[model samples]
Target: MKKWKAVLTALLATGMLTGCLGNGGGSTLNSESSRIYVTEEGTFQTATVESYVQQDYYNGDELKTFLEEAVSQYNGANGQNQVTLDSCTLDNGTAKMMFHYASPDALIGFTTQYEDKENQVESIAVDKLSEVYGQSESEGVTFIKADGKKADQKAVSKRGESQTVVVTSANPVTIQTQGRILFVSDNVVIKDSHTVQTTKGKSYIIFK
Candidate 1:
């Protein structure tokens, strides 16, 4: 198999990591080494995996340790509701750490406090999926036709957004003035300035 590199995004980072790296640095949780290295600008804190010795393989132990460290650091530094690691999972060298925080503002505060320490946990999941799948497919962004004639009509995703519509007619199609044509099968034709262009002019345009 190919050598794979999994990148775990840090939804939480301790003040120590941020102090050194700035707020964009990351913490590396290594399963094989049973250790976590918190990196900031260019410095890091090397800690033994002692804090997570009893947890499962999915880096739950390491995640808990990180969260504890982060919360402690945040509380001591800012005296606020610190972030918590809600869940964790490890696959293909990537560690996924989910966290629960008060709000985006709180999240930003946490990030600012430990920014040199990294990206959110969602990116780790993204990396894992990217590694497992190798490639990705995306349907291009669609611009809605909200102001056109069919204002009330919604745009349905029929296959990819890049597809085009093809319209064909079997009979003498009538394009009415109001952009709508009612084809009366010889039953009724309430014509009030709504003209129907026919291929052949017939007397009894039998619109019963």
Candidate 2:
């Protein structure tokens, strides 16, 4: 099986659900879209779900084997254990799978192997917002607090230097990081204290 379709076939085959992207991860078992969990170390895991009517020829066991094999091959080629198939299951016309990667790039590399663009999610983690999104944009962008007030520049700057800023773009992804979220860009919608969602353009998550 092609590495690109590994994430797709596992989810879209059954038309189930999907996962997430960011320097974040979570234990959420079910999500309408992809939910990604990232650590301070940059390691991350994604839980994807897809659901569709089950066809008579669909064999859950065979699909699982094929997915595991693909994961093995990818890990072997990309460095042992760089990517792992944490789980894959198909039940009652729903498919759910989780993948663990050494880094967000590893996950991106695996999902976006196809050139034509399927399951293409790009994510990067930087120590500061200026590191990736640039100093000009970082300084100019206004982030909001959980209370819905604009984040002050002094506080944002104080934590900006030590914060982990995760910038990612995907098909409606939910991103969670281990650090406390301090601010987010206009494109980012705060889902919780540590989780956010972005649909258009690049989304930024600045956390301390």
Candidate 3:
């Protein structure tokens, strides 16, 4: 009886330790706290990336105009198009823009040209409506798929030396990292779901 009791106590202690370690593994990227606005005028939605820094990276009005112009151009060229800017906001430490398209093909067309345009500001944009899952790596960015495939992806250029990670996907994703800057171009639904933290240079999540 004495030996059995000792074994049970040891097992319980091990379980507790495992639970604590599991909880400390990764951080969540929640999109609920971001400032999101939706409107029928052009069927547009806008959201700002919630960040530790309060300073605005891009002029909101200017970005709105840019997106509006892009939509006009796309509509003029395509006769059967329904793609529109879903949201544009500054989150994390970078600028991010998202667009909604009627189909995957439409998204492809817009990404080809809009992504190549020369601009004074550095920002990330999604060609189609997507849900991005990302985690910061010490060397660069790492993306993981729902089926456990490591995705090969790169970040959009930044104005400064700081590195940025951009991940776009149609399905929800899981991220594992210590902490890094990320700018998402789609609606983000944090896997585990946690509060957004705003400490300069600390780990946090921002959805655009």
Cα deviation at 177, candidate 1, in Å, is: 43
Return the TM-score for each candidate structure.
0.29, 0.73, 0.32
lDDT of 2 by residue, 1-208 (tens): 3443455555554434433333433434334455666666556776665655676666667667777887787777888887788887777876666778886678788766522122346765556654544553545666677555787766765664645555556465667666767787666788777777766556667776
Candidate 3 matches the true fold with a TM-score of: 0.32
Ten-residue stretch with the least lDDT total in model 2 = 18-27
| After superposition, candidate 3 runs with Cα above 4 Å error | 1-57, 91-93, 116-208
- Worst 10 contiguous positions by lDDT, candidate 1: 120-129
Q: Please report, as a residue range, the 10-residue window in candidate 3 with the lowest summed lDDT.
A: 16-25
**Quick one: ranking by TM-score, best first?**
2, 3, 1
Quote the RMSD, in angstroms, for model 3: 22.2
Query: What lDDT is reached at residue 123 by model 3?
Result: 24
Models, CA RMSD each = 25.9, 5.0, 22.2
* Candidate 2 ranges with C-alpha deviation above 4 Å: 1-32, 114-119, 126-139, 160-162
lDDT of each: 0.28, 0.63, 0.35
Task: Give one digit per residue, the lDDT tens place, for model 1 in 1-208.
Answer: 0111111122223322221111111223222221112111211122221111122343545555655676678767765655554445544533444444544344445644544233211111101212321122131212222122221112222212221211112222121122122121122122322222222221111110
- The top-ranked prediction according to TM-score is 2
